[model samples]
Target: MTDATDMAAVRVDAPGTSATARLLAEAARAVDAPDLVLAVSRGGVRTVHTGGSAAPGPVPRELLTYELGSASKPYAGLLLARLVAQGRVRYEDRAADLLAPGLPVHPAVRRITLRHLLTHTSGLPGLPADFYPQAVPRWSTGPYGGYPADRVVRAFLRARPRRRPGTRWRYSNFAVSVLGHTLAAATGTPWEVLLHQQVLAPLGLDATRVRPGPDGTDAVGRRRDGTPVPALDTGGFTAAGAVRATPLDLLTFLEAHVGGPEPRDPALNAALTEVTRPLLRRGLRHAHTHTLTWFQHPSPYGRVLFHAGATLGQQAFLGFRPDSGLAVAATATRRVHRGDTFVATAYGLLTETP
Candidate 1:
C-alpha cells in the first residue's frame, strides 16, 4: 500500500542517500506511520530521508521533528563525561555531594554515585515508587507531568534502593533526573541552560529542543489509524527522556560518538569517547552490558550501541556501529505499542550497513 508520500521520500540521485531512503521507506511501512524520518551517517557524512506529513504544515525535509524519549540519555551521559574531562566533576562523585547540602538523603540513596547513575546501576526506580498513584490516574495522558524539579528532589531523598547501588543494574528515570539536577547544582546552572551550554549548542543542534519547547512545532504524532496523539510532557523526568529533535541533528549526535570530523572542546571530545566504552555488566548470567549511558549489544560490526525512545505520540531510535562508521536515526509519529518494530528495524539498518 505505497503512496506518493512514501515514494516521494525515496527519490534517487542524492549521492549515497537513496539506499538509506529505501531502508527508511521499509521502516515506515513496517510501523504503518503517517510520517517517518531517517538519517544515516557514514564516515561523518550524513543524509536525511523523510516521508508523509506528520502535521499540517510545510515541514522541510531538514526539520521534521519527533520526541526522542530515552534516546536523550546519551546526551546527558555525554554532558557528565565532558564535565569530568574538564575536571569539573568526577565519575565517582556521590549524588549527595553534588546535590544541595543537607538535602537529607536515605542511606542507600547517599551511596549512589554519578557513575552508578550513568550506568543505571544506582538501583533506582524508573520513577519515584510513589509516582504510581499519579501514573494510575493519568496512565494514558501524562503521568510524569505534574511533578517538578523540587518534587523530583524530594522523591530522590525519599527513595529506598531495592538493591545496593552498583550491585545490580536497573534503568531509572529517577536516577538520571537527579543526575541532571546534581550536575546543575554542581555547576550553578539550570539543567536546560547547562545542557545547551555544554552539549546541544556545541553540537550545532539548533533544531533540537530538550526543554519545554521551541514553540510552533512542525510534526504531530499520529496513530496507525491516523488519530493525532498528544505530545508527551516529561515533567521532571527530563534527563531520562524529554527530547525532541530533527533526524539530521540526531545523526550529527551519533556521528560524534563515532569520532566524526568536527572541532570540539577537549572536554566534549573526551566525553564523546567515554560514553561508548563499556562501563558495567549485570542481569542473568551477566548477559547485559552498558556503556556510560547506552545499552551495548554485540554485533558482527563490533558494538552496536543503541537506545530507543517513545513519547506519547512518537518513537525514535539512535544507534551507531563504530567499527563500520555507521549510525542510523529513525523516527515515526505513532505511539509505541508492545510489538512495535520501529526500533528493531532501525537497529537492523545500522548493523546491516557496511
Candidate 2:
C-alpha cells in the first residue's frame, strides 16, 4: 500500500527520538559501508536516518530496500503460524509427511515437525556440510543462488543430526529451508506468493520483495575489498533467508510486532502473536528463550525480542521491547570490521535511555 508519509520529508527531533537519532547517526558513520539506513519506532513515534553512500545521490530513502538475509526467518515462521491458525497444517505434523513422493530420508527425518524446525531444535545442522563448497564459489551473487531444492531435501535425508531432535537447540538454515518447502507443498502455493498474500500485502509492505529484482534503486552489497556483490538469490531456499525490504517497510513490520499502528487484519495479528510467544528456552548470553523465529531476552524493563541476519556482504538486525514499545531495525551495505559495531550500537540504543 502506498503511504502518504513522504519519503523525502525531513525527520524532526520529536520526543523520544532525538537520542535514538543521535545513536543511529553514529552507527552509520562507524560501519564500513558506502551507505546504510537506520529506522526505529518507539511509543508510536517513528524515525529514519541514512549514512554513507557511493551513489551520486542524497541519503538513502526509507523506501530504498536492502537484503534482510536470515531476518527472513521470521517471515517464514509467521507463514507457518498462519497455516496452523487456518487449520490447514499443525505444528506437530511430521515434516516428512509433506514432502513430494520418492524423496529419500532417514527414519529420524520422519519425526521432525514444524515446531522442531521453527524453534531450532530439529537436530539438523546449521547447514549441509556441502553448502559452503557450493556457496563460496558464487559468494558475489549469493552462496546458494539458484540452488536446487530437491538436492537440499536429498542432502537432508542422508545427513544425521549431531543430537536427537528436540534434545538441544541448534540454529539450522536447513531446517527452515525444509519448513518453507514443506509449507509451499502443503498449500500448493509458491513460498513468495504465500508470504506476500498472507503477510506483506495485508500489512501494506509494498516496498518489500523476496529475491529483490535487479532494480538499480536497491542498495548494493559490497565486498570487504569494495567490489559490488549481487543480491542473494535463495533459489528454492527463499524461505530459509531471502527477504529484501526498505527500512520503512521493516519498521512497519516491527511496528506490528510491538503493537504499533497496523492494519486491522485479525489473522495476521494472531499469527504475529504466535510468532512472538516464547515457545522454548535457549540458554545463551543475554538471550533466554526462542519464539517462533525471534530470540527473547530478559531485560530489566521487559522482555526483548531480537533477531539478526547476515549474507555475504550485508547485515541486518531487529530488536524491540514488546512491553516498553521500543523497536529498532538497521541495515548496512558492506560486511566489514566495523559492521558488527553498527548492530551492537543499535541494540544498546534500543535498550537504554538517552
Candidate 3:
C-alpha cells in the first residue's frame, strides 16, 4: 500500500568499498528486478536494502513483507527438532503413534516418521491429487482458504503414497502439513502456537507470522504478468508454505543457521545444530545432500546451505556459508520465469565472496 521507499531501511551501512558496491551492482543486474531486496553480510560488515525499493529513484526503503513460501519449511523441521530435544518426540516417531487414536490413517502413513517428512522422503505427492481441481477456481484469493484441519488430515489418510517411505526423495507439501498436525497431536499444542512459543519468540522474530495479519508493512505479491496475487490462505497446511515475514526477520533466522546465538533455550540451541547438519543424501548426482529441510551444496568455501521457495506469485531464498559464518537472503515481489534472478544473483555473490 505504501511506497517501498517510504519505509525505513532495516539496516544501514557506511559507504561500502567499490568491491562491495560492484558485487551488489552485479547482483542487481543478474536479477532483472529493480524492486528486489538484497542482503549480504560477512564478519560484521553488511548491507541490507532494496536495489529498486524506489525503482527509478535513489531512495531505498525496506519493502513490505513477502511470503517466504517453502523457505518456511526449515522452521517446521526446526520445530520437530526442538520437540525431539525436549524428549517430547523422536525422529523415528510414527504418524500413527501421534495421530491414530480416532482418526483413520493410511497404513503407510502410520509408518512415516518426522525424519521422512522433514527430509522429503515420505513419498507423498506435492499436494493431494484432488486439491487442484477443487482449488483452481479459487486461485485468485487463495486456493486453500478455510480448508479445515480435520479434512486436510482425512485427505492425507485417503491419499496413497507414491513410493515406500524413506526409499527415495520426493518433495511434498502434504507431508510437512501432516507433520505439523502430528506435532500438534503429540504435544497437545497447536503447531502455530508451538512454533511461536518455542522458535519465533525465543529467536526474537516477532514479525514472522504463519498468516498475514494487519501489519502495515505487508506487501502483496504479483504474478509474472504483474497482476496482484492475493496472499495464500494455507489453512491447515500452514507448515508447508505459509510463512510471510519481513526480510529482516528472515535474515535473523538465517543468522542462527550460521552460528548466530541460539535461542535462550539450551535444548533448542542443540537442536538447531542438529537440524542444520546433513542428514540424508538425495539419490542424485554430484553428492548433493539435504538436512532436515535445507539443501546442502558442497562449495569450496564450505557446504553452502540453502533453500529457495516459490508460492504462486512470490519467490524467496535463504542461504549461508556455515564455514565462513556468512549468510545471505533475497526476495522479490513476483514469481517470474525460471525461478528468480534475484535469488540466483544473491547466491552467486555469496558463493563468490571471499
Top model by lDDT, which number? 1
Candidate 3 at residue 162, lDDT? 63
**Candidates' RMSD to native:** 4.9, 2.9, 4.1
- Give lDDT: candidate 2, residue 176: 92
- State the displacement of the C-alpha of residue 17, model 1, in Å, after optimal TM-score superposition: 7.8
Cα miss at 280, model 3 (Å)? Answer: 1.0
lDDT of 2 by residue, 103-152 (tens): 66676776788889878889998888878887787766667864678878
lDDT values, one for every candidate: 0.77, 0.76, 0.74
Candidate 2 lowest-lDDT run of ten: 1-10
Task: Give the alpha carbon lDDT tens digit for every residue of 197-271 in model 1.
Answer: 898877766678775454555467776567876677888888888777877777777877787746344457778
- TM-score against truth, every candidate: 0.90, 0.90, 0.89
Per-residue lDDT for 128-159 in model 3, tens only? 77778868998766787657678678877776
User: After superposition, which runs of candidate 1 have C-alpha atoms over 4 Å from their true positions?
Assistant: 1-18, 52-56, 212-216, 264-266
**What does the lDDT read for residue 39 in candidate 3?**
73
